[model samples]
Target: MNTLFGSNLKYDLKASLVVFLVALPLCLGIAIASGAPPMSGLIAGIVGGIVVGALSGSNVSVSGPAAGLTVIVLDSINSMGTFPLFLATLVIAGLIQLALGIAKAGVIGYYFPHAVIKGMLTAIGLILILKQIPHALGYDVDLMGDQAFLQTDNHNTFSEIWYAIQYYSIGAIPIVLVAMGILILFERPKIKNHKILGVVPGALWAVLSGIIINLAYGVWKPEWQLGGDHLVNIPVLDNLGQIGNLLTFPDFSMIGESTFWIVAATIAIIGSLETLLSIDAADKLDPHKRTTPPSKELVAQGIGNSISGLIGGLPVTAVIVRSSANVASGAKTKMSAVLHGVLLMILVLSIPTILNLIPLSCLAAVLFLVGYKLAKPSIFISIYKNGWDQFIPFIVTVVAILFTDLLVGIGIGMVFGLFFVIKTNFVRSVTLTEMNGNYLLKLQKDVSFLNKALLMKNLSRIPSGSKVIINAQKAQFIDHDIQEVLNDFIASCSDKNISITVEGFKYKIHENI
Candidate 1:
């Protein structure tokens, strides 16, 4: 246990706490945004943290209700009108994921082009910048903040921006500009090198700016609520007893509707893609050069979703935001995730009041950092250096994801990459080995015109005096290039008295004495 647990579980606990701090607000925000009962997010987190953590093979992935699933969840809820029916679909989605895992379909992740991933991160980052502006400027019109482009204040993203602009709070705008300036200036290495700020994360500084602005708003415009659309408004509880009231069961009678299945399918596919993509990224970040068991993750997610459905929660996956937080916090094991869940439960139950102190703007700042990590310039440079083959799909994937939805873009990019690889491998001849360490160039399949280059390259590698066997016992056809090479090589072999065996293919011997 110690070998796996490490010497200081302290780091894990600390990391877990950091992640929990981040997860708590997101859970509620996502739940509300998905149009589900606010309690659903917390339930998913509890299940993801407690149940999935124990069962997962992933060392660092933190499971939760992801923003990606909001569209599916909300759609399901709308169509079904009953949460229980939605729950049934969640169960089905889980089963499908489990089967994918068991079938070792984890390779599906590798097919995504790197460009698409880069594009995705960049797009999400751009969306983050747009969404956070309202919160940074203290607009509180609707909680439709960050990446989910559907606006609650208005239907379109542009309208949401317009709404924020029209009601732009002077108190909030100045604060945002000041904080943004500080963020940009501090990010410069020359300024950061002074150690005056002493290794403060951009998010911490941003959050600090938010608190200061929040307090200033209290004094300058106390009568007017400056933050119109960006505040996180989870209902605060005074005591531990309030947690019991946190859960909200979905109405199950809507199960008969076809929309429930459509929603369920949406959740499963998108969730799986998101999870797989995250798994690939997390593996790349691992110091141990480990490949996470994607299939196991699918099973774990299946179980998580099943449980979430039964207990009235949203779908679960290995969310990149929380996983990145786990990495940033120096987590070394899944224990960090498990403990984070426990901490979430405790805090929600015992100190719900403490959570109210954190402002929504502060959380948006953290998300800003996350979006940046996913879309950094270095990621772009690295993918380009990997050569055109890797670069193309990656680019396509990103472009598709940005313009279209997540899964569609990745699918298009992967198709291109697959064709490129297969077309490169079809022009080859076969080689059979003899027991005596020599090699036989054997022709089995049809010696199509494509085999000429391979035949030439191979014929050039043969030593001056080495014995060779040419066997074509099963071949029905031999192209001219192959036959010519074999016929030409016999002269040198006879001159050197080199042993040669030609089986199944008739050849005339030439005497040159």
Candidate 2:
């Protein structure tokens, strides 16, 4: 057990420190955007790291409050009336996720086509880049990690960019440019491969550079100084008891509302889906190529969300941004994730003031790097080469997600993918062969119910008075609708004087002549 984590202590600690640094600003920003107490995001981050990290089967994936669900969460909090009442809905959502895991609903995760998943990730990448521009310019009106097209302040994603350009802080410009330069230099192979220097993540240095630049500005160019609004805003705590004082408990009184269940189910399904997709993406990113058990991941997320909600936190999911950061930072085990969580708890409890000193622009610069990695233009070229069947859905998903929300975009992409599936199946569901005068009909692969009309038409084309042969040996599953059509055709075979022979059918032909 110790070997699973302790074996890579040096590497894990370094990686965890990077992830912790990345998470701190996001936790507070998401909470502010969601209309919940800033501490709620921190709570969710802690639970996601320590609780979900320990319980999850994933080695590289990191869990926390996701920007993908920010719109839904904010709407829920507003519509639900109170933060405690919203917490109740979150608890219910966790319970629903637990039931889904037990029911093996995780299998649904595998059904998402690779094209769609890639599209979703790519869309998120684009959103991150666009949304963070305002923060990077030190506008700081829109909270960090708010991925939706529309902002909490009524400004849409693109409008935020224009607004930031028009109203950006002159003082923030130099800090962001310097931080971004440091980050870009860190990406160089020479620097990245160095033993001692490579050990340090660019994000860490970028943050430090931002702080120092701000300090220098404050000292010399006092007129161009950034205020507290431009920096991280974690609540200051004087003692351990103050932490509990900030915690908000769930209001169980709202359990009887029908609307409560609807909200719960929504969070559960979306959170579970997001977690599953993030796990899949993280596994692909892992250098070791380890696979995570989907069912166990769902169970872990359920437990984490439940605890997070009970103590006032947003719904948690396996966040691709942090997971990708963890992998890029050289995390070896779940221990890194746990350590990040512990550090988050410790920082918020002990040194929140120090954290508050970190600039939002620095975090935005780090996310810009993360976003670039996910949505590199080469990815689009590769997907496009895969042909329209793959590229159409991929492009459609990216566009839909940009205009709408994550789930809606995914649904759009899946629908296009399903159309392709049905089209391909319609063409090959039934195969034909002729032996002398006998006509043979063979069902290939798993014939879907979508092929019923085509199958019936093909069967009708079989000349009357000709012997017919039906083969189901290669079929893994014959849809019940197709089976009924076959049964009806077989029952009328005698009248047409077309004698029929059947092979490899598991079920008896009903009303056989």
Candidate 3:
């Protein structure tokens, strides 16, 4: 146990700081997007990092308030008539997630095709790049962390980019350029291999640079300085003693309302699905290639969500953005996640004023790098080389996700993936050959109704006076629809002057028919 925690303390600590930086703005952005108190996002982040990180079987996944849930949270909050009632739903949602974990529903994640999973990762990477461009340019019209193509600000992803171009902040450009440059510099072998310099991540330096540069701007270039929505906006508490004022408890009175149950079920199901997908993606990104136990992750998320709700926070889920950031920053274990949570609790409680100094554009630069790694050109080329069977679904998933939301995009990709699977099975299940008026029809494996069309087409092409042999030796199970087709074919064989023989079938063929 000691070895597990101690072996990679240095790496985990550094990675944790990077993840803390990445998560800070996101937690606040998602809360704002959801129309919830900004403190609720931080609470969710802490619970997700500490509670879920400790309980999860995952080595690298990070959890927090997800942007994907913002719409649902916003609509629910308004419809429910109060935030505390919504908090009650979150508690029930957590309980339902626990039930789902106990029922072993995490296995559903494994059913997603590798292509679809890859597509999701690439899609998210693209989303990070496209979405962050505006923030990096200081066009703060849309909330940070909003991933959907259509923004609440009445602009689509592409349209928003155009708008950002027109209204870009001059001050933010220098910060983004410098931060991106520093991030790239840190990737070099000399700096990365250095004993002292390598100890700190590029993202940390970028953030510090952003703070110092902005402070300098305040003194020299007052006209170009960034403030207000351009910087991190976490709520600052007056003191540790007033922490209770920020924490809101769930109202149990709403528990008896049917609407409360509906909202709970929605949160539970969506949260679990997102968690499963994020964990699967994180496992894929792991350098050691370790697999996380999905059911255990669900339980962890459930506990995190329940704790978050009790403390007046948003629902928690395994978030790919933070998890990917954790991986990219060289996290070695779940300790990074836990340490990040600890840092969030300490820093938010102790020095929110200091944190508020960091510019959002610098953080956007950090994500810009992380996004590039996930959706690199080589990844697309590699998947394409695997042939259309894989590439079609992968590309479809990428486009679907780019145009719509994550879950909806995945669902569409799943349908295409499943179609290719069925098509492959249909082709391989049956074979037909004809030579010199002698015909052979072979059922190679389990023949289902899907193969019936091909079987009928083969039968229809046989010429009159042909001698036919039906071979089923390799088939384990033939569908009733296929059996009926065979029966009808046999009944009509006399008119065509076809001679039929059956082999390895379980039932006797009607020779006289």
Candidate 4:
């Protein structure tokens, strides 16, 4: 164990710090957005990182309170009439996830089409860029981690940008600019390769610079100094003993209710889906190309969610944003994820006031770069080159995700992707061709009802006084609808003066025709 973590300690330590910085605001933001106490988000983040990270097979994937579940959390809390009641459902949800893992339902993650996955990644990238613009400009109207198109503040993603433009903060502008500049500079080979400087990730420097800049403003330019909403606001404890006051226990009394079960099932299903998707994405981003066991991931997430809920935390899942940041920060193992959780726990309990001093704009700059990397122009170009079959679904997924929420957008994209699959099968199942004055219709594969329309179209195009051959030698099975269409076509052949020859078909044909 010592050798395993010690070998990559430096990389993991640096990477953990970077992920800690990234996860901090998101935890608070997602909690606030869910109408839950800010501490709940931090607790979930802690559990997600420590519990899930320890149990998961993934090296780079980080689990936490996902922004995707904010709406569900908010609604469940409202309907339950108490946060404790909602916590009860979350515990049940975690147990359901455990059951799903035991049932080997993790294979569902593999069923997602590659186009849709790429689309999801791209969509998230676009969302980060669009969503963070307002924050970068010091517009604190929307929560930091809110990724949906429509905002809780009644402003859509783009509309929020317009609002930000009109009322941009003077104090935040310089901080973000400097932070972004430092981040961009740190990306250069010269700076990144430097032995001493490269030891630290660019995001930390950006955040530290943001803090210093904000403090400098306070001293020399008090009018432009940003505070309150523009900065991180974790609940500070007076001492270690005070931490117990922050914990909220679940109310198991509600478990017998149907509504409780419904909420639990919803959370389990959605959280599992999100976790599977995130882990897949994380694996893709892993430099070593490691694959995480989906079943084990589900089990880990189940345990994490259960523990989080027991302690008054939000439902937990593998989150792509933080995982992406982890991978981007050069994490080598799961130790980074575990250490990040430890940092969150220690810092929140020990020095939350120091964390609160960091600016949101700085984090926005970090996310801006992460988003850029995910949605790079080259990704689109590469996908487009794969032809319309791939590009169409990919673009649809991106657009759908941009307009709708993550699951809804992916569902919409899946519909389009499924259509192409069926269409491809429809074309490959049957073929029609002209030879001299005759026509040959061949069923190359199993023909289903889906091929009925194509068969009809091919049959209708046969000319009068022509001979046609219907070949089904290779087809393993033909649907009843397809058989009916063939029978009708054969019956009409006499009127058109077309002679039909059947080949390799077991079904009875219209011999009289």
lDDT of 3 by residue, 227-314 (tens): 9999998788777889899899998897888899999999999899989988999999999999999988888898889999999999
The lDDT per prediction is 0.69, 0.86, 0.92, 0.91
> Residue 315 of model 1: what lDDT?
90
Clashes (N, CA, C under 3 Å) per candidate: 24, 0, 0, 0
lDDT of 1 by residue, 1-513 (tens): 886666537657766876776787778878888888877888899898988888888888889888777776787777766667777788778877887878888778876654555555555555565666666555655563234555554355556667767776656665556555665675576755455562444445665676676776678777533442345445667665656676655554655767766777777878888889877766655556577788888888888888888778889988766887677656788899899889877776665554554566566556566566667788779888988877777777666655555556556766877765644443434554545546587777666566666776776666656678877776678777667666777767777656777777754433431
Residue pairs in steric clash, candidate 2? none
Best by lDDT: 3
Q: Higher-TM-score candidate among 1 and 3? A: 3
TM-score of 2: 0.87
Best by TM-score: 3
Query: TM-score of every model?
Result: 0.72, 0.87, 0.95, 0.92
lDDT of 2 by residue, 1-513 (tens): 677656687678878888898898888878887878988999999999999999999999999998788878989988789999999999989988988888888877788888888888888788878878898898988777677787777879999899999999888888889889998998898987789897777778998998888889888998767877899888887778776788999997878988888888999999999899888878877899898989888889998899999998889999988897788777898888999999998877888777777888888888888788879999999999999989998999999989887878889999998887777777787977777779989998888788888898889888779899899898888888988899999888888898898998877767553
Question: What lDDT does candidate 3 reach at residue 125?
Answer: 95
Where does model 3 exceed 4 Å of error?
433-440, 461-469, 490-503, 509-513
Off by over 4 Å in 4: 1-7, 433-440, 460-474, 484-513
Could you tell which candidate, 3 or 4, scores higher by lDDT? 3
